[model samples]
Structure formats: structure tokens, C-alpha cells
Target chain A: MQKKSWNWNRFLACSEENMRNLQLQKLLERNSMSRSIEIERERETDGTKGCCKMEKGSSGYISEFLGSIPTFLRRCLFQVLSFGPIPHHIAFILDGNRRYARIHHLEAGMGHRYGFLALLSILKYCYELGVKYVTIYAFSIDNFKRKPDELQYLMDLILEKLEVVLSEENMVKQYGVKIDFLGNLKLFPEPIRKAAEKVMAATAQNNGTVLLVCVAYTSTDDIVHAIQGLYKEKQARIQQTAEGKQMGDDDEPVECSGGSNLEEFSVSSADLERHMYFAGYPDPDILIRSGGETRLSNFILWQSTFCLLNNPKALWPDISLWHLVWAILQYQRVRPFFEKKKRL
Target chain B: MGANRNGDDVTEINRIHLVGFFPNDLFQITSSWRLDIWNLVIRLCWFLLHQVFNTVHIMMGIKRVLESYFVPSGLLDEYKDLQLKKLRYLAVVVDSEEALQTLRIIKLLQWLSAIGVKHVSLYDMQGVLNKNKETILRSLSNSRLWEESHEKATFLNGGKMTLEFLSISDGREGIAKAASYLCSKYMKAKTLSGNQNERVFTESDVDIALKAVGCGGPEPDLLLIYGPARCHLGFPAWRMRYTELVHMGTLKSMKYGAVVKAIHKFLTVRQNYGK
Candidate 1:
């Protein structure tokens, strides 16, 4: 009876201690959240605008000068940020564009329009930071499952953006960004595909930065495409080897086929990777999905095996230089852990 | 607000404050002393922001540990009563270093089972968990908490717990295997009509190939990564297309309430399938 009473008393004390811990945690969270928000507000209010939103209208030389002030300031920030590890390849999963439009009560295709502008700004930021590669998931094959009208609107918008990107006045010319479209181009309309090809050709010489736009693409499709390419290549080689063996004369065994048989065609990861669409390009270092959702949603599964995955609360349209910087910061923080994983 | 130092260009700057700072003016960047000061200030700001982010991360870690202990005695019982229907399959990925502690893994499983998780896939990069599968299964079975389907009389909490042990081989390496497996299988049929087989292979074919190779089982709805870094550690890429991955810290500090909280978060989140 005495032992039971002692156990009861211990349990009571533990419950009280647990209550205090919960309250303390809540208090700590509130304190930190408020402090961070205050700090963030001060930082954001200062120079949110960079060269990406360069007003083309007749705002006169004065507004332009005001904008250049922040631009100059940002360049300074980038200079300092360069002291840390700058990600060689940065990829963006352009999620939440449509949702942003919906929330803002904008037109059906305006979300994508804003998203394109955000991309340009982000690209400028990345280039300024000396990043070599920028990959954007512009369209997915699964996105085709949407309404036909919406898909048509998106294609038209894409064409317009292509023209904007191609013009000598844009960042493409300023940064020497070589544009390459990844994924299944065959699935897209002839005009879109042709325009994409034209853009690629126009900027092929530019070596400053490489911009990879994944349209009508899915990672699974990429893997499958690689598999198909390898399969066909192997079959042709086997056929050539078989013909050679057939031509060979005098007691040479045909079943084994001089050791160059189909059975000998061993497939490995590197061999499969060589056939992938972005085979030559290095894997993305940081994958930033600009939206609330944390899922990859079938974007670059094979490539993003070891990269940092950041899902900021901001939608794709709302993503600013701040978002990009935050993602890079997170990536730098986890670099040691990733390095350890690689060593293992 | 930009300073108008040069009297030659006299109009006040009219910049939009919403999105970005674009230098639309045709004026070239002039070197100035104040510009150097601005440069110094922002670099300082950058360092400060970096330190702030680091502090937030540390605070979150501390808060998580505290909150894990903050689970009330009553909530433990409440978790058992939680009818988790949304989570059809759950996965736990332990960091290779922590995967060695078999007892911790067992406790984690027990906690998960107690919370009414029906199916779970346990994974580690180096296949440490898979190597001890027999011992784990025997111990779990001997616990008498979960019973086989044939014996209805002998069972405690979970109706029947289905466990899957996974490793790196079942992930990235499995895809390589599937490729070769598909190649050899299709190469035989391709001899008849090589021209017709030139088309791109579809996703369905890959799925069929994976099944034929017996690489890995069904995709988990929620994958809990127990590691220092927020990584899947080469969990099967194909299966994790839409899997909600949550890092539950390392296995040494495995908490009952944290798992319960994660399961709760999983239950609360609305899974949108390409909507």
C-alpha cells in the first residue's frame, strides 16, 4: 500500500512537470516567432524590388534612378553572400502559380504571367550570385490533364515569354543565359516546340549561365525515355555484332557470338544517366518548390536524390529574392550533413 | 528613396515598391563613398540574418525535444484511440548510423503500432535494419501484441501489423536493376520487329518491369525520415513521388509524442493528387 502511494505521488509530480514544459515551449515559440517576424518585416520593407521588375513604361529617369539604388544595394548583398558556398545548380518547382492567381482574383492565365516575371527576377538573382545553372519546371505532362482551354492559354503565354526571353533587351542577353528545354518536347504543340528550339539556338553561344526549362516533362518519363534510348542503342549494336559473327568463318561458335551477345548487355546507373535529357548538365544542388505543398509532384526524382528540398509558404508568383537567399542559406547549413552522407 | 547627388539629373526617382528593384534608367553605375557604406551595412545584415536562421534552427530542435516530453499522460491514451484512416502506408527511414540500435527501432515500431498504424516500411541507407529483419520479426511476433490472421483468439492492440524492411538497394539501385531487367525481357521480343519497338517506353511498362523484378513494394503515403538532414537517403524515387516526407530527428532521441504528432500531422494534411 505504501509503495502504491509512492508511485502515485511520482506520477502526480511528473504530470505537473510536463505541464510546465508544455507552457514553456509555447512561450518560447511565441517569443521566437514574434522576434523573427519583426526582423523579417524590417528586412523586407527596405529593398524588395530588384531589376526584375524594371518598369518599361514612361516612369521617367527619376523612378529608374530610385530602382537602381536598390539594385546597387542588392549587388552589394550578393557580393557578401558570395563569400559562402554558392550553389552551382539551383532548380525551381514552379508550383502555386495558378493558386496565386486564384487568391488574387486575377485572370485565368495571369498567374503564369506573374510566375514568368518571378522566374526572370530569380534568374537575375542567381546569375548575380554567380550560379551556373538554373532549371525551372515550366510545364508538366500531367498539367495537360487540365482543361484544353487552360492548356492552350498556357502555350500562348509560353510563346510570349519565349519572345520576351529571346529579345536582346532582356536578362537573356544581359546575363548570356543559354536556354535549353528539357523533357518530352514531342508532346507539345509544333509551334511551342519550334519556338523553344529557336530560343535554344539563339542563345547556344552564351556561356554565362544555362537556363533549362522543363516543359511537358516528368521525371518518370525521363527515366523511361532513357531506358528506351539505351534499349534501342543496345539492340542495334547487338545486331551489328551478330552480323559480324555470321560473316566470321570456320568453326567460330555463333551461340556465344564471340562474347558480344545480348546477354552481355549489362545496364548500370551511369549508362542510363547518359541517355537522360539533362545528361550533360550537373544535378541540381538545391530544389526550391515555391508553394505550401511539400511533395515533389513528379519533378526530377532521379536528379534530386541528395539536394536540399525547401518548401516556403510563399507561392511561386510571390517568391522573391528573399526566398531564393533563404533556400541557399538552408542549403549551406545542411552541407556538412550532405557531405557526411556522401562519404558514407 | 535614392539620393540625388548629381545636380545634372534633377528629377526625383519614381520606383515601384511591390516586386523588385529594376534600374530602368539609362544612367551607368557611378562609384561613390556612400555606396561603399551601403555595401558594408548589407554584408553585416547578411551575417546577422545567417546567424538568426541558425538560432531559429537550434531553437526548433530544443522546442521539439521539450515538446516531446510535454506530451501529457492523458494524450498517450488519446493517441491509441485515434482512428488513423488516411495513412494507408507509413515509412520510417533511419540514418545509417542510428539504424544499429535495434531496441530503439522496436520501440518506434511499438509506438507506431500503438497509434494504430496498419502498414509500415522501415528503411536505412546501409540495409542495417534489413540485416536484422529476422530478429525484429521474431521479437515483434513474440511480443504477442500482434497475432497472425489464423489465430483470432490471440491478439492485443493492432489487428495485424504489416512491416516492410527496406534499404538503398530497393531505391536508386533498384531502378538500375529494373532497367536491365526490362531491357533483357523486351530485347527478346524486339528481335521480331525492331522498327516497331523504337517508340519511347511508357510509365506503365516501367511499373510492370519493377513488379516483375520484385524490387520494392507499394509506395508509402507518409515517409518519416529519422536523420540529421532532411533527405530521403535514396528511398525509392518512384514510390516517393507524392509521399509526405517528415524528418523526425535521429533514432537515439526517438520520442513517442513526436511520432504521434507526426502521425497527427499526416492525418490532418489534405493530400491533393495533381490537383
Candidate 2:
């Protein structure tokens, strides 16, 4: 039985209670003195069990009413109170499109289409849940390395999604989401790039939600471009400043002689954020990676510092409102952490 | 010790296990009664540890898979000498009520200080609590860090100021008032206040209110955190613009060994995000 591997008795027998305590003690020894005490205090406090047992008579109505309310509604109430704290900026590694298609025994491009459908719904759900920023890693820097036919098909699918943005049936216009493409756009075929540019231009005015579509994106590549851009901006600024100084005219406003790479002279975390592709936008509050994958396959590198990560054992195409809700629920659980960290 | 020699040649010695354990309805199974809270806590700790171990195992497995699938590549030569050391001054923005965790966080900071980490400014953005200043002072007095800090070493002074004045007013008017007050009343340009949006003072200029007070210098370092999510929020971005943020997961998940390990890795490891 699967339960055999999860056998609690054997696991406990492997190490006696005293032995386990000793092990814990040794581990605690490695920690700082105050930390150890804090940990101990936490352990002691948590070790104590608290039960709020209400009387069965008068409060029965409340419980009954609560039970009568739909589970979804109850969840919505919980969500509103919590505000889904962690993972303010979330990245979606939209994987398993092909597998989902195969599982459903559908056509090759159908899976990608279904994934887009799911993305549309989930995007709305995220905004409703108060998620500020969402980045869907629709394509990878390495994905272009796939077989030629598959690559062409994927590119075609992306173009379709982009085209759909302009379609009257599409939600991009309805939702007013700004679409920004991250990754090496130059690496993509011309048609795909043109389609992407069309969507970006169309949604440039809308500001309700920012959907970062990482088509040919890789974390490392993003950093490289950011640094290169920073350098270029800096050189241009220096040239402008030097020219201005040479002209001996201070009246043209200091802004024209604006300095860049000033961050290099004195860098801070904010400087790095401005240098990033998704500058001005908030970092991901929650990172949702489906397909049962718990690892960040190089999503946002510098930006995801205090992000709440939600890994639902669902496929990319299988991601529904429930999965998004579950992720938000998870974020709500650790809301205090975000609240505390925000003070910094 | 086999190091993770990927991308930037950073060693894989430091293992990060970001596991979150939340208490819900089922949590009552082990901890419904008040007395059983201790027992439930121990079980939860064990559960958390189990999850952490699972995460580590998964990370190792993924590492192995990547190793087999990919070829070993050299570090990006252009970014080889990327100093990144200039970025410093960490402003930790947090909510007001959860600022109570500041006591626990103080222990973390002390551990941070012991490890040669300098200059952290704490700002409470959300004014959730309204406790008496005397009680707050007494609470801080009980803390070892507060006791250890020199006259110049101030950590817990900025919370109240940030929450009341700076956070909402957007660091301009409040900072100016505070700066002037500090210069006139305290006679120090950098007088530290406790529990406010603009907490630590480095100068009379209100602009520096948004700038990080310390944690910047010749030495390249890190800004370790214990928080809920990843975004720095409104943490006076001016100071932390380039800081290498290492989220220690949540406060409950924070471990001393983890901090040491992360710092050890940050210092020893080389970073190359781009190839």
C-alpha cells in the first residue's frame, strides 16, 4: 500500500523520543543563544494545545448557518479578510500544455489554446484577488531549442494569442491589462515579434493589471540586458552631461544633463529594480508554478525576495479558478509575514 | 562540500528550503485544546522539518537532473568583475501590529550583527498598534540587542515615527519635521526614533529619510529578511536598490544555521545572472 511508505510507527521507532530530542538539542546548539531561546519558546508555546469548545445549544444556529453557506462563499470571506498577503508578485511557469493535450487526446495546438483560455480566466481571478502583478512564463529561452516543427507550432500558437488580444472576443480589452513582453524578442521569428508588438501597443493604455509574457525569457538573459541597458543609459547620460558642461549653459534645466549609471556610483536595491525589465511594477507577491513542480526554473531573480510561492499539483492547462483560489488561500495563511516585512 | 557551480560559479553549499506551514481547521486535530498547544507545536515543527527535508531532497534531485541534462558553462566574462558592493542600506518596511514580531526579529538582527552585518533600518508602514511609548521602551529594554547597542547604535527607534508621520504623508513633510526636530532637540543630525515609517536618521535632510541609513560601504554584503512575500513593498527603495535580498522565508521558518549558511554562501559565492 502507498501507506507503507508513510508508516508513522516505523518512522518513530527508527529514533526513540529521547534520541529525537537529543538530535533537536544538537541542532539547537548550532544556533545563536537568543535564537535558540526564541526557538525553544516557540516550540514550548506551540507544543501547548488550545481548544475553544463552545456549548452545543445556543451556538448551534451559527454553526448551522455557516455550514449552509456555500464553501466557495466561505472561502471568499476568508480571502477578503486575509487579502492574500504573500506572493505580491507571482510568476507562472505555464508548463504541461502538450501533456495536457495528450492527456485529453486533443490536437497539438488545442492544448496551447486551452492554456491561453485558462490564462485569461486566471488573470481575471488574480486581479479580483488583489494580486498586483503576474508574469506568465509562456515560453522559455530554452524552449526555442525544441524540435523545429514543435517550435514553429508554439510560435504560431503565441501569435494566435497575440492576435486574440485585438479580437473583440478577447478579454484584454475588457480587462484593460497592460501586456509587456520579457525575453529576447529578437530571438523570436519576425511574425511572432510583430504580433507581440501589436498586442503590447494595443494594451499600452490600460493599467488595471500588468501581464508580463515571458516568451523567450530566461532570468540570466534578463539580467544581462538590464545591465547592458544600464550601461548604455549611463554612457549617454555622461555624454549629455559632458556636452552640457562644455557648452557652459546651466539654464537648460539639470534634467537635460541628467546622469544615468549614477546607481553604479552608488547602487541600492531600488536602483536594481529600476534597471530591471519590469521596473515601476511591483515584484511578484505570489509565485504560482503548476505541474507539481516546486522549483522556480529561473523566473524573477532579484525581484522575488519575500514572495509567497504556491505550487498546486495541477498542470498549466488544468489551472482553474480553484487552483488560483487555493494559491491565494495559501498566501492568506502567511499574511502576517508580508505585513511585518512591509514595514521594512 | 560540493558547491553549486552554476551560472555565476556560486557554490551549492547553501540549501534553501522555502516551506510554509499554515494553521487551518484541520490544525485543530492536533491542537484544539489549550493544553495540547505545546504538543501540537512540536508536531507542527516536526511536520515543518519533514517538509523542509522533502524540499531539500527535491532540490537535490532537480540539481542532479539539470547537471545531467546541461553542459558546464563558464561564467559571463563581462559581469565577472561586477562589484555590486556599492549597494547597501536596508530599510525593512513592515505592518504595525506584526511589529510585535520585532522582539523576535531583534534576536535575528543580533545574530545578523554578530555575523558582521551592519546597518539595518526598520520601518513600520502600517500603524496597527497604539501602545504606550513607555511600555514599548520597556519591551525594547528587555531585548539583548537593545542592551548591547552603544549610544550610536540604534535599531528600535524608528517604528512609531514611520507609522504616524512618514508612511502615509509619503516621507516628505513628516521627515522634514522629524529632521528639524532631531537637529534642534537632540542636537544630532541622525537621532533615531522608534517605530515609524521614517525610523533611523542619518542626516538632517528629509530626502535621506528615503535613503538607507547604513548597510552600505566598500564591502559587498546582503540584506537578509524574514517576511511573508518576496516584494520589498514600499521599503524606502532608495536604500535597498541593489541589495542582494535573501528571504529567510517567514519569521517562524527562520533558523540561525540558515542565516549563517546564507551569509556564508553570499560572501563566498559569485553571482552571474546572465551568461
Candidate 3:
């Protein structure tokens, strides 16, 4: 067939097929360039099977050669792909801990403990990756409905975990992480509550990372509490006005914070944000619900604005470094899109 | 001596290699000086045009692939409209801080309201009426929405909460309460038949219930859930069945824009496949 001249606008507007062709071409070029590394990654777990197919020189040699590339250039590439304005905060709906334990034929409490330990490791990685905030669904407010025995076991497990987390020698101190508990802590047993408090107090000075543990938490509860907080703020404002000798007995409207109209008394989004449990922290940048099922069980309601979602078909305790790496890669891929939006 | 034993095998391989002459030397141009830009341009144009033709030819094939991964930017724009226009009832689940979180919830609801969104229900499974009582009073002590939606939304503490009314004081009792709550509420709203202790308000109780409150009519057009699993594990089914669900990960990491986007995604969804 006779060929036509090139048009840039046409190329830009060229439908999905053209875009796919461009993507595929890039993929093929990248594949060819990284063929050696790809091969090594594939062989990493089953090294013996593909040992004979490796090139002359050890895997260490290849790694060294690759590492020789300037760190700056690597960073630039990473930035272009997935960098700053990245998910400042990431929340994990750590579900199926018990199921994971069951699959491995372990006890339920043991599963939760394992999950807690895994979460600690994940938090360390988040800090390392420069993530400023992390929220975990530790326990639900609804979970109080469980049998007394199961609840007791969970409480014990949480107490032990909190003690470990709050210990001076633990990762919380080692990494300078600030800890906060969400949901209704009042319902927890005294020991668990005290342990949770100690952890929060111990990590209070550490501003390097914000770790929000949703123990006895539910999104519905969080919203309701936020509303409750707002009400308190309103009453305080009214009391302040009254104490100032400015109380007009005519049922007059009272001025609130930031000079919002008293007649309207409507709360702005920004105003309401100031009263949330996560008032001081950044909104979650990415929300990952790890389980076969895809839904956001009452988790973070108000804070997940503009967050990238990564639903991996793996349970919470089953989550590993590999899953974290995959999630990061996905974050990196979508990071540019979000960054561009921010700039706009 | 061992090499001699493998001589035939080596010879057979060599024979296969040279069986047909390959075009290589003519195409091999080692030097940039010998490159032909004009000829390359012509070939490139030919390739480009061929691709354009191929793309235009298989339109549906291209659509399927794109739909599988990328939801186009244009569609996202449309999503904004769909989300804003569609009647959405966002269920913000909270526990003890129902009063505390209510301010933020109201802020979120007010934002949605400002955007012309119709319903914003902050469902507290834990009945956070104590600690949050001060917060709620503080937020709405002078607000108009408090006065207007006061009946629709109010503070409920441990005492006022009931299993029959879906007032779950804690997580343990939430599930059963939620299920029964959904069933009864949906049943009554649709004027459906109740158990022996109740009256049958309408014929085709199940169907009417499903339609009016279940997956049918009065169904929450969209349910943008926030919290733990991606599933709406605790949301009342009467509202969740046909509702488009979008999860906002957690509270500590909550962002403002994510709420907008979740609503946007829900509004843009095409099918409300059965409950």
C-alpha cells in the first residue's frame, strides 16, 4: 500500500491501537535492553534449574556492572516514573490474618501476632521509602462482637504486640515513628488500652513517621467521632464568645473559628479536616486492601482522597517484601499521572 | 578419540545450518557514512501508514484492550458529571468518635452537598454519643444543616443504640445488628410483610423490599465505603446491593480528593448488576 505523510496531531489523537503500538514498541525495546536482568530475576528463585543457561561471569558480576550506572541517573528515572508527591501516606486494610493462619494450620491468635510482626516490617520499609504516614486496620469497632474467648485472645495478643511495639529497643523507637490509635479505644480492656496508650506516648516525640493503628476502629465510627469533635469545637467557640462578655441574649448567632459567618455556621471541608482523628497527618496516598475480595470494608472514610489503590489477591499476614515491591512498582507506574494532576 | 565419536552429530548440525543461503551481507551496513536516510524515511512512512490502517481497521479489538487497562481521561471527565448528578448516599462508618468524626463527616457531607449531592448519612455502628457528644454540639450548635437534618441525623450513644434499630455499640454485635437492621429497615421502607410480630404492608414483600430499599428503588445509588477490606463487609445490604462501592483506605491517611474521585467513579459506572 502507498504510504502517507506523518502528522503529529494525528499521532497524538491516534486511537488506542496506535497508543498500544507505541507502548508495545517501548516494551519490546526495554525488554531487549534488560533481557539479562529479566532472565536473572526469573532464575532467582529456581536458580539451579537455569544455572547452566547463565552467561560467562557470575550473577554478582552482572549486578556490579548494573550498579555502576550513576545513582543520580537511576534516581532521575525513578522520579520520572514514581517519585515525590508520592503517596505521602499509605493505608493497609490488613485482612485475612486468621485465614492466612488457618491456611498454614496455625492458631488464630498466632496468626494475628504474625500479622503484627509483618506490619512492623512493612512500616520500616515505608519509612525507608520516605512515606510519611501509615495507617493499619488493627482491629474493628465491630470486632467487639466476637465471642468472649476470641476477644480475650485478641486483646492479649494486642497487648503483647503493643508492649513489643512500645519497647524502647523496638522499630518504633529505632525509626522515630509517631503512633496514634484510631476508633474507639474506650471499649478496650484496661491492659490493652494502657498498652496502646504507652505505645502512643512512647512514640509521641518521634515525628519522623506517622503510624495510625485503627484498633477498635471503623470508618463510620471515625466519621461520627469527627462530627463529635466538631461539636465540641463549636461549643468551645460559643463559650469563648460568652465568656468574652459578648453574649447577646437574643438567641443571636455566634462567630466561630476563621471568621466563618455565624448565621450560616456551615463547616467547610478544610474546617472539618482540622477536627478529624487524622487531623495532623496527610491523607493516604495509596490504599491497599490485600485479599482475594475487592472492597473497602469500613476503613478510612475521609482521608483517602486522591489515593491510588492496589488490591493484591493476598491476605494480610501473607503479604511479604515481594508484595510490597509489586505495590511500589504499581505506585511508581501511576505516580506520574497523579503528579501531573497535582501540578495542574 | 571421543571427538571422533561425535563427528557425525557435529556434521549433521553444520549441514542444517548451511542448507539454505540467508540474506545478510547485503543488509549489513556497518558504517553510518553508508546509511540511507531518504530510503529509511520512505520505509518509516510506509510502516506508520500501515499501522494507522491496522488501527482503524480493528476498532473493536483496540477498544477491548484499552478498556481492560486504561479508563480514558475523557471518561473520567464524564465520571465527574455522573458522580455529581447521581443521587449518592455515602455511609461513613465510625465507632466511638461518632460525634468527633461527625464534624469531618459533616464537612465531607457539606462538600458533597455544595456539589449538589443529595444524601450523606454518617452511619455509626458503635454509637459514638459520649466523647463525640461535645464535638457534635460544638460543630452544629449554630449550624443550619444541624437544624434541618437534625431529625435525619442525630447523636446516639450506647443507651439509645438498639440491635433492632441497627445501633451497634461495638464491632462484635455489629454484623447481626447490621443484617437485621437492613432487613427490617428495607422491609418497612418498601411496605413489605414483616414477621408474625409485624404487619404485611405490601404484597410481594420480598420483591417490594428489594426494589424499594434493597437492590430496587430507594437503593442508595452509590455506596463509597471507606475502611479495612475492599468489601463492604458491614454496610447494610439494602443499601449496598446495587450501590457502586469505592474504598477510601483508612482515616489517618484520608485525602479530600479521593472522596471526590470515589464518588466520581461510582457515578460513571454503567451497570447496576443485580444485588
- In model 2, which regions exceed 4 Å deviation? A1-89, A105-109, A169-171, A249-267, B1-275
Best by DockQ: 1
TM-score per candidate, in order? 0.77, 0.44, 0.46
Cα error, residue B119 of model 1, in Å, equals 1.8
lDDT score of model 3?
0.50
Model 3: residue A132 alpha-carbon error in angstroms: 1.7
Model 3 per-residue lDDT tens digits across residues B34-116: 33342344335434433454465358445534542343344445434543545534455443232344556546555554555
DockQ of each: 0.23, 0.05, 0.03
Off by over 4 Å in 3: A1-86, A169-171, A246-263, A339-344, B1-275
Error of 1 at A340 (Å): 2.2
What's the residue-level lDDT of A337 in candidate 3?
A: 43
CAPRI-style docking class of model 2 based on DockQ: incorrect
Candidate 1 residues B1-275, lDDT tens each?
01111322211111111012333241235244544464455446657767888898789889987776766455445444555777878999888888889988988888777777777888888899989877787767533211223443332244668777778887767888888878876675565454464555788888987877777467788989887767777788878877887878788777887887777777767755554
Candidate 1 vs 3: which has more lDDT: 1
Query: What value does the lDDT take at residue A175 in candidate 3?
Result: 52
